[model samples]
Every structure is written in structure tokens, then in C-alpha cells.
Target: MYQLPFTTVVESATSNTKKLELVVHPSVSSKFKRYLDIVGSLVGLLVLAILFIPIAIAIKIDSPGPIFFTQQRYGLQGRPFRIRKFRSMVTDAERLKSLVSNEANGLIFKNKNDFRVTKIGRFLRSTSLDELPQFWNVLVGEMSLVGTRPPTADEVMHYNQRHWQRLNVKPGLTGEWQVNGRSRVKDFEQIVDLDLQYQKKWYPLYDILLIAKTFYVIFGRIGAC
Candidate 1:
């Protein structure tokens, strides 16, 4: 029997320690990349300040909760961090998710239309405006401008060995999955595959390309939300 770092018992008796260990690579510890996140996030925060006011106002008028939404998410090395986003859904959205979720494709729940999403939430999600506040997370070193998508604690709990590999580096607001076609790919396993692909190939040039493609995705409004 093999003991695991996360728990006393493994998820499967046949699970291979070598395969699980392979998920975390040594190159994940990149000091220069962390520095880049700080500088880039600060610059992004400065630019987003202009739109913050109007977006905040819209959210205030549309809902009664706090202006920002904060939740626990896994960061570099599977550490927990409070990731912030603009409030796009109603305060009770999480509580109502089970009822509103359309179906589960493996670990993720998807719904083209969810009832708990406020009017402002709909627009924010569609434009990816809800994610603006994550720049602060990036600045503080909890995330990156471009990397694997962060999974919530609940999501992480559901992750198998391959999916946990995403946490080898800082999570990002945009990544290969976001620019590739976010809404079109609803399968949870496929999302995990993309994250693994990112972990194996992170570099400054790749980050730059991801950022450029992200801009195009944002402007082109293709498969967002």
C-alpha cells in the first residue's frame, strides 16, 4: 500500500508513485517568472483602474453583495490562496450551484444558462470583466498573467493525479484553455489535459504568445463565457 501526501490512503491501489511524482517538475520554481507576474500585474491594475468605477457601479446597482468576490484557490506548489474577482454572480450563487448546474462532464459542472447569475453577472462573464480583480492576485504572487487555470478547493479535491499537475505553477486568469475556446470545451478531463500541456512548456516566449492570443480572444469575443 502506498501512502499519499494528501491523505492516508490512495485513490486507487494500482496508482503508480512514479507517474504521480512525474506530475511535479523541478523547473516549476522560477524566480524570474514570479518577478514578471508582479510587474505585469501592477501595470495591469493601473490600466484597469479607469474601468473599475463603472463596472463597480453596475455591479452595485445589480446586486446587493460586496463589490468583489473572493474564494480559495490552489496556487504554486498546491498552496492555497484567496483569488479575487469582480462580483459577477449573486451572493448566493455557490449555494445555488447544485440546483442550477446543468450536467457534469467528469469533475466540472456546466450550464449555458444558470439562474443565479445576475444581469451584470452575465455581461461581466461574457466580457471576462469579472476576472479583472485577479490582477491583484497576480501582483501579490498568488497567480500569474499567463499560466494554468486555478482550481477551487472543491475542484482540486476532485482532481486525479494528472489534474493536480496544474498546481505545479501559479494559476492564471487566462491561459491556453481560455484562448483556445473556453465555452466550447466543457469536458473536465480535456481541461486537465490542457493544463498539463502548459506545465510541460512554460517559458517567457510562450507567456508572451499566450498574452497576445488572449488579447485577440478578448477583442474577438470568440467562445468566451
Candidate 2:
């Protein structure tokens, strides 16, 4: 296991003022995990390279917009990083969000039948192919192969101090929430609870198990879209 000295920055549980506390460094078990992230991302990128042309062509033909979507997401310790995804919605999707009613739980927005989604986008979401570009984030150390899901800037803004604990670790391409029933999970608190559970019990073998379960979820087509 590999460990890094870290400082925990949090607002006082009782006070409005922010505070910093240095906790004893925990064994990270991340050296091999980082190695796996590098190797996995490389292989993923190679597959992306092979699929890019066809996917790009499909996206362009289905809608008039960029092939990729980039958004700012909170990473480890609430650091901001750009996350990339294959575009699956209208070019004006974010702006149009205000016009539609949200069907998701907590601070997130989700609509299985969202009109903003293009025909190809539906398939992309169902297959999770839209997330393929995140392998680049993994390669760059902005993300992990398995960990907590990254929150959007808007999502983070709504979070309380307890919610910030999830940011202690690098966000992931897939995680407990995803495998446990991602699209099906309605409450944001449940998601937070699962992330906290992962943090408390983190180990290399645990990550491997989650990764295996993620494959089953993906191929089984459960809780997708």
C-alpha cells in the first residue's frame, strides 16, 4: 500500500468558519491502483482511437454539434478539472435544462425521456459509451478506474460539509453508486453514503471487486440510462 500525507479541510461541524485538520495518513493502496489506471487508460485510449472515427461520424450525422462535451468537475479534494464525454444531447442542452422538469433525485438532473437527447445519444447513454473519453482523465491522474463519481460545480455548491468528505479521494469512471443501481438510485444522500462507505473501507482488492461488478452491470445492461 502507498500512502500520502494529506490535510483535511472542512468547515467546523458546529461553526460557520472553515477549518483545517491534519489526520494521520492512511495506507493508500494506490500505487498499484495508479499503475492499473495508467495501463487501463492506455488500453482504453487505444480502443477509443479505433472507435473515434465511427462514433464521431454518428454523432455529427445525428446532431449538429461538437463530437465531445467538456465540463468542469470536482476531483480529489474538490480540485476542479475538465471532464470529457461524447456529446449525446443538443448543443443547447444545458441552457434548455431550465425549461424541462427534472426527474432525478437530489441535486442532480435526469430524465430518461429527455427531449434534449438525440437518437444516437440514447444508445450512447445506455451503453455507457459516452464515458469512454474519461479514460484520458484517468491517464492524466484527474480520475481513477474506480472511486466516487465526480460532482458538477452546481452539485458541489449545494453540498454540506459532510458531503465534502467524498471529495477526499479522486473521482472515478465507475463506482459503488454506478454498480449498485446508478440511474435507479433516486436520493442523493444514498449516493453520498455509498461513497463514504467506499472511503472508509478502501483497499486494492475492494477496488478490483467493484471493477468486476461494474463489468457485469455494463454488459448486463442494468441501471443504465
Candidate 3:
């Protein structure tokens, strides 16, 4: 059993809305969760180390840029943190975002056939191998093994008060959104709804279930890419 942290209310000057931020303090279960994150992340990082060379070589052969993609993402309580992933797009992909047509609904961007994705990148994205580096984030406490997907600063800038609830807990490498429908889910509001639902019903067992489902989703390719 665990307790939902107290809520802290803050006024948003830009939107003139009150945002409820959950202030989670370390509890026994929370500490256990963190312990699991550390152990799991260590194992994950070992796997990443084994595959890093091959993936890096593939990226370099496919594109002329850094092998790792780093971006600022909102974490717990809307704090900014740098998130890392294997680069799966052309070097100029970010610059080209404005010119490309978005397939996703709401503030987030998604395009199944995005031209910016390199051949190797497409494969990596489909296999979710590009996200392997995020274990480091989990190991360092910037993320959890299971929680809401982190949002980009640009995406968070467009979020409504209710949408902000998702950031109450640490972001994750895989969560309800990843296991549910992923890119197939066109509506961003649905993703937020899932996040809020996860928050409301969070338990150690729930996290375990999500992690188990994630493996099936990935290996089965239910909604990959």
C-alpha cells in the first residue's frame, strides 16, 4: 500500500490556470520502486552495452551525425531533464519538423512514414531499440521503469491544466501509452487520460503488470512504430 502525495497548487501565468502538482516524498514502497529501477536499469544498461557498438555502426553507416539523440523532456512535477535515445533520424530532423505534416492529433507530433527517419532508424524505431539508452535515465533516477511517457518542452507548453497531471510521477521508458496503442492512438488526450488513470490507480502490482505487458507489446509488435 502507498499514499498519494499532497497536491501543491500553482498558478500558470501564461494560461491563467491553476495546476495541481503532486509532491511525492520518499515512502517505503516508493523506495522499493526506486530499488527496482536501479537494479533493472543496471541489467538493461548491460544489454545496451552489448548492442551499442552494432547500433552505433549502423547509425553511422546510415547517417552522418551523432549516434545519440538527446532532448530536454519534462519529468516528475514538470521538471526539465535531458532524455537520451539512439538517433533514428537524419541530423536535420528537428529543423525539418515544422515543414513535415503531422499525423498525430493534439500537441504531440507523430508520422508513421516520416521522411526524416533513416533506414536504420526506421528499423530501430520499429524494434524500440532506439530507446535503450533511457535505462541510464532510469538508473540515475531521472525516470522510472514504469510511468507516463515524458513530454517535450514544446509539447508541455501546449498542455492544459488537466494534462499536467501526467507529470506528477517520474516519466518512464515504457508505460500505458506504449503498451496500449502507441503511434496508432492519434489523440493526445487519450494518452493523458491513460496517464491520469495510471496515477490514480498506481500500485507495485500495477507497475509489474505494465512491465510485463510492455514485453509482449514489443516482441509481438502489436503497435510497433
Report the C-alpha lDDT of model 2 over 1-225, residue by residue, as the tens digit. 433335566664434645444232231336888888999899889989999999999999999989999999977766779998999999999889988888877877877778999999999988888999999999998899888899987787777666777777788998889999978887788999888778777777788899889889989999987
Per-prediction CA RMSD (Å): 5.6, 4.0, 2.7
Query: Which tens-of-lDDT digit does each residue in 1-225 have in candidate 1?
Result: 111134222442222322133234433466766777778888889867988999899999999989998888767656777877888788988888778856548777778777788899888888888888889988876778887777766676656666666666668878888988887778888887787677666666677788888889888888866
Q: Model 3 — TM-score against the truth?
A: 0.90
In candidate 2, stretches whose alpha carbon ends up further than 4 angstroms from where it belongs are 1-29
* Alpha-carbon lDDT of model 1: 0.74
Candidate with top TM-score is: 3
Weakest ten-residue segment in model 3 by summed lDDT: 20-29
Whole-model lDDT, model 2: 0.82
The true-versus-predicted C-alpha distance at residue 222 of model 3, in Å, is 1.1
Off by over 4 Å in 1: 1-27
Candidate 3: segments with Cα more than 4 A from true spot: 1-20, 25-29
